[model samples]
Target chain A: MNTPTPAHVDGNAAAGVLREVFAVDLTAAVGQCDNCGCAVVLAEARLYTRAPGMVGRCPGCQAILFRVVRGPDRTWLDLRGLRCIEVSLPDS
Target chain B: MGIVSPGFSGRRRTADLPPGQYLTDDFPVLSAGPTPRVRPEEWSFTITTETGREHRWTWREFRALPTERPTVDLHCVTRWSKLGTHWEGVSLDTLLAGVETTADHALAHSYGGYTTNMPLADLRDGKAWIAFRFDGEALAPEHGGPARLLVPHLYLWKSAKWVRGITLLTHDRPGFWESAGYHDYGDPWREQRYWGD
Candidate 1:
């Protein structure tokens, strides 16, 4: 089996952790980068997991757009780095 | 439904385990970019501040600084914890002893364009190190060799790999992750993993 390089992953790589906090899959969410003003789906953001947490960067300008840090007691989701996070909820 | 790997069930609960972390005997390799390959002869560490002051040290010179071996636990945001990991390197305290700065934070720049930020206080007073050796040998490039910042107090991400320089800032500025969505001050023990939480 080929192991994916740590730095070359995408936002889809973060779906599992995101689900733990958001209840729904967040890979489909669209977000805008605050740093370079680029917009894209959350799943398209560049991801890095080599650290103690998961970090997602804007694919356009390489700005960190989101980060998810999960601890024993609680999970921390920081989306302020992104200008906007738009999630499409399923029609009830 | 999630698919489970056949051999992935070896992990179990442990008292020493931090909240939400699973005990893993394996040390996983995680990175935001390709592994950087650096030659000791061509490598150097620079310390710069917002004021434009800089301190440069070649590999030989950096190794001359006092070194220490500390065994600590590593907690990855991905829910894995490995304990009793041993590393050897110069203490940030010794490296910053003579340097004077009013900076409150640091931006650690790596060879591969990767950066991570932390309060300057977190890197001093025996809190962090520039580790060059792991498991009694030279650090491999895949694991951030030549030297990498080791910040045990925070999640391992605060420990920037392939670290080449430190830019001290008078004010806290988000590095690669902080600018993204990660918590500014990541203290795994306190579960300070995100922004508002």
Candidate 2:
């Protein structure tokens, strides 16, 4: 799966740095939610400079996240929302 | 991992900035950086001096206070530099009259445990403010809703986002960006954005 990197825009100091700004195109996709097994469509996908900006958000399960893209003839899904996995909930 | 505090000795660096610390594109890239579209009303503002004094400000009083313009050069940790950012807010010098701070003890505080030292002379320069508006409009949340401390002299992060209040301490405290591997003092000219040269 190939992800597109954002192009950095050039401007004055007031324009700000991190020059790279993602040229995002909204692409819709259908997703089978992991939690409820419900088929969700019209899912949004974004290609970011650092990574896949956003994927499918479970309107039903806010906890569920994913990173979707087109790979060859198939639609690839990373099935992970945020890049951060270090934060952990307190154990019971 | 430890008790996080601004300007704490032995601070961490952005190199260690956990993951997913990228800017967003919620607003129409107003000037830069993504800002939230939803406007948050129930927010707080604070004032801190080097004298260890702290005060809270509400939206009403914050808006009611005299409005002033400050031409600042804004430097972002992301490396975007915006100059001559004209802001409207009460000047730091005007705010100083509300509380007293000796020339020796003066520091500016921000959200996420960010702090910056200020010389008494600089405080008197009358160029700083708890800005609530930007680009001649209400300050959006992503741009630090409600009110934020704006220090135009240094880097933009020194301005502090989601500003809760200011604390006047005898010593200077490093802010979130400072501790998290960002240059303690972000200078666009120096290109001091992150930790280490």
Candidate 3:
């Protein structure tokens, strides 16, 4: 079976890139969209990498939720669109 | 040794192509969420400035305005260049005609809640448009139908799809990708793709 062309993918598509900065699985965390107030998992947010970095937009409203860019010496993260992000703690 | 395709050829060359970019015939779809299904009658365009003033135009009203057909090249920060792309839309200059403003920036808001910011100068003098047609056809819903901001000079993300409004500001406020780690000003020629390039 042929898969249709994807305009964008879910945040999980950026897991490998994100792993450089985040110790835990960011795709599994829940994030809220500041625009429409929709709360969903980061894995559900749409992902676009056609640009230089990974952009996670809300699935409900398409509002940007998070952005991660890796530079030569540091990693930059912007999460201003999220009212809150819930990440489960790993077992000790 | 690496295997090469049957018709493998080195990167194609063109005077218009920018650095670190490859040319392609495909128009790849890249969105932040599901494609928004907007009804023609329900669609509208708005422009709001820092002073809380607003100008609104419905679908029909917007189409009644003048439009321009431009055949230009598009460069994605991810390194794809689709040259000679055709588009038809109302120029931002016509939309902002006779409108007074002391603003320096504008945030483009889309139907699906997506937003991107750019300088007010970027939308002037035929620099951008609210495009509704592509390649002589009505834009597909998957490609930001109704209309999308077409800012060819910058990276494609600056061209917000499903665009619905422009909020002008006297100060610079980062939108979507700008706030996120991407460069605030995505100039393909300059290769400003990340936070610091």
Candidate 2 segments whose C-alpha is farther than 4 A from its true place: A1-92, B1-41, B48-52, B103-124, B194-197
Docking class of 1: incorrect
- Candidate 2 lDDT, tens digit per residue, B42-79? 66566555544566666676667787877665544444
A1-92: candidate 1 lDDT, tens digit per residue: 99877877778988876675487677898888998887779888888876656878888887677777665566667787698777776773
Instruction: Give the best candidate by TM-score.
Output: 3
Q: Tens digits of per-residue lDDT for model 2 on A1-92? A: 87777576345753432222212221333555565655555333222322112233556644344544332234444543433222212342
Write model 1 residue lDDT over B47-87, tens digit each, in one string.
99778888999999998888999998888766788888899
Candidate 3 chain B weakest ten by summed lDDT: B6-15
Best-to-worst ranking by lDDT: 3, 1, 2
lDDT of 3 by residue, B125-145 (tens): 989999999999999998889
DockQ of 3: 0.29
Model 1 chain A, TM-score vs. native: 0.70
Local error of candidate 3 at B60, Å?
0.7
Quote the RMSD, in angstroms, for model 3.
12.5
lDDT of 3 by residue, A4-63 (tens): 999999999898755654778878988778989989899988887655567788888777
The residue ranges of model 3 lying beyond 4 angstroms of the native Cα positions read: A1-22, A26-66, A70-74, A79-91, B1-12
